[model samples]
Target: MTAHYKNIVVHLPNWLGDTMLALPFLHGLRSVFPDARITAAGRLWVSDILHHFPPLDAVASISSTSGLINYLRGEKFDLGFLLPNSFRTALAFKLGRVPERAGYALDMRGILLTHPLKLTDAIMRESMVEYYMRLLEPFADISEIPRIMKLYPDEADRAEARRVFLENGWDGSSKLVGVNPFAFQWDTKRWLPERFAEVADRLAERYGVRCVFSSVEKDRPLMEKIKGMCRRPIIDLVGKVPLKILPAFMEHLSLFITNDSGLMHVAAAADIPIVAVFGSTDWQRTAPWSQKATLIRRQQDHEPCMKPTCSRDFRCMNDISVDEVFNAAEKYL
Candidate 1:
């Protein structure tokens, strides 16, 4: 690689928090090769989140397996980081003829790697970034783990968010707390809508804060259900808000109460105080990385079932009551 190494590719994770988790490693990559042009590729839903990441010299879109192959084939990248642990990611770089590629030797992708490092023993016990940083240790010794984070929002984005609040009749004079009850795109992962409504009602009554519900287009009905449960005048801004508006709106939030969803991850990245309610997910493994986040996990072991439908009823999340989350909200309120 020359002084101004032009092309570099990074594969980002699918989930929002995991995508942010890769920021430190992304920063490290930039530190090692300062002038290298960095391009990140991932799912379309992640575009909302990664669009705010400045480390990326540019962002690339890969819709299909062929698209990934074609994009990598087109760009003669000097180096690539396969942050997404998959055989296909490693193979894409190999087929694209990238000279230097570094990633964890996962899913037999080691066969395609120019440099593949083993996962650290502590990685299984620690956060996701530790797993990613381990890949870079062989290239250069990372003595102290860097506290890397990202929140890049344009002025237009902020203006749009303000417009959204105005459209919803929010004057921005009173305290506004966001509620995100829809989790991953799975029925079992969601906490009961009635329970969220109950909690929203309590927050409004106690804190004198208005509740603004947030969710993807598919989750509009879920937010409506919360609005139904609210005794105070609640403003429902679920499906109408655009992705670009999210970061700035989240910045203005007094606090965000949510389930294990992408929106929750976004709030944490924006350095907004968060009261995260955990159900089936493991707080230790996927807890909010921000200093201001307060993770409220039910004291139940063996809960993180990565499956969409659990054989057993979701006792872990179901056991978490409206009262528990309301109690945790007291500190942030």
Candidate 2:
């Protein structure tokens, strides 16, 4: 039997990719408590990601534990779903006096939770989307897990994307391919920039699709390196747009080729086909959650180590040839 809860506050994960993966869990929670008002709360940037999600009545941005507790106290939440396994998260809900706090029993915070779910190695080994959805099991029946995750980008976002496209000389008629070569904060996950350039040049020439390279402003140097290596014309829009417009811009693309990064998940949320390259990290745990996606990982003896940097020759990423990635992109185009 499902317990009756009138109001619920779900604390979201910190990272963009993980937050996107939690869409299924959020949807399932809504299904169980249809009448309940759900508030999705997290860091400012992460909370912004949930802005367009309909199930959430509001999105609260938290700067610190004390601020979060005060915010929760004012909201008078009946239930708290702490998606992040931080001890601080559990403590805030407890201090806020939320009647029931539900989360994984990790970080020695089990005693703080009204309902704590035990997490084992087997569960940790599962895909991240599945792992996040497991948190919903203790409270809701959750008979079916959603395979395709959902995100809602409003008309304004689409309009901004269109404005940027026209300003950049992109005609609405041409098939566009997006190349994302830079991974945020993880150098090990990045494939060779020259290789990415080579593949983009080949795909653009063969298919006649307008190839566009995108990255945050901080990654402009890397994007420039890739652009310098390219033989054919590739639009360099690195650092020009904001995160809110990314999904809508991604919607314009026929396909997205990228490393295992936050943008990969964003592109997946936009329902675009992807050719995601994998290296130090395991695609099984953090691959794009899209049926239209194709993953390119080298089959090495020791790979998917889940490391941020490689100590060895970095064969896992280097071994993957440009031809392999080009072939994958060709299939989608």
Candidate 3:
């Protein structure tokens, strides 16, 4: 029998990409408890991006453990879900006095959860979308989980995206290709700036499409480096576009070429055709969960390094040629 949950609180994932991947789980939760008031608690940025998402009734910006506990206590949540596999998060839920808690039994937090699901090696090998969907098994049929990830962009978001495009002189006559040259977590995951520049220029020359570059504030220097290397003029929107408006902005893109990064998932959710470059990270686990997406990674005799940082001179990324990436993008264009 399905448990009765009136006021449910879910601790969302910390990373933007993982948070996007959790859409299916959220969908499943809402399906099983249609009338429940579901609140998503996570970092401030996560709350900001998911503010307009329909599945969530409210978004709580969790700053510290004590603050999260206080907020959860004040809300009197009947049930809680921990998307992040951290002992601290489970402790917060327990101390917050949530009656029922469900999550994977990883990090030795099994005792804290009322429904502690096992985390298996097979589940670990599955795509992140599937991995997150597994969390719904106790409450609903896993097969019912939504395969397609989506983001709801409001009218203001669309207007902001339009304003950025117009200010950047995009006339909407030609196709716009987005190139993201930097990865947030790992330098090993990034393709060379020169290669990215070459691919951007080649795509422009071949398809008559304008290349638009994007990244966060900290990665602006890398975007600048790529822009300097490119022979063609590119629209650089690094640090200018807000996270909330990214999905709307990506909807205008014909194609997105990027590393296995947060924006790659955003583009995938936006339904943009993508060519994602993969390196040290496990591509199978985190590949864009979109049919329109194409992944490019070098074949290796050994397993992927799977490290945050690489010491092997980033051979996996370096081996993937600009021609290969351009050809992948060409198929979409």
Global lDDT of each model?
0.77, 0.86, 0.88
Model 1 agreement with the true structure over 1-333: per-residue lDDT tens digits? 336557888888867668777777888777766777888888776755567567777787678777887888788788788887889878877877788888888898887888887775667777765666676776667756475765788888888888888789687687988888888666655777788788888888888888888776787766666677767787788778777677888977889988777777678778888888777665676677788887766554565766676677677678878888888777888
> Distance from true position, residue 237, model 2, in Å?
2.4
Candidate 3: give the clashing pairs.
none
Please list the residue runs of candidate 3 whose C-alpha ends up more than 4 Å from where it truly belongs after superposition. none
Off by over 4 Å in 1: 1-6
Report residue 76 deviation for candidate 3 (angstroms).
0.7
RMSD of each: 2.2, 1.5, 1.3
Highest TM-score among the candidates is held by which one?
A: 3
lDDT of candidate 2 over 1-333, digit per residue (tens): 455788899999998888888888888888777888999999876787677788778889899889999999999999999999999899999999998999999999999998898998898778888888887787665556555487887999989888887788687788899998888788788998889999989998899888888877889878777767989887778887777677788888999999998889988888989999998887888988889999988877776677787888988888899999999999998
TM-score for candidate 3, residues paired by index: 0.97
Candidate 1: 10-residue stretch with minimal lDDT = 297-306
Candidate 3: minimum summed lDDT over ten consecutive residues — where?
301-310
List the candidate numbers ranked by TM-score, top first. Answer: 3, 2, 1
> 2 or 3, which is superior by lDDT?
3
* Candidate 1, lDDT over the whole model: 0.77
**What is the C-alpha lDDT profile of model 3 across 1-333, one tens digit per residue?**
554678999999999999988887888888888989999999987767888989889998989999999999999999899999999999999999998999999999999999899998899899988888887777888885567588989999999898998799688677899998888878878888899999999988888899999888898777767778989989988888888898899988999999999999999889889999998889889999899999999877554888777766677877899889888889998
Off by over 4 Å in 2: 1-3
Could you tell me every candidate's TM-score relative to the true structure?
Answer: 0.92, 0.96, 0.97
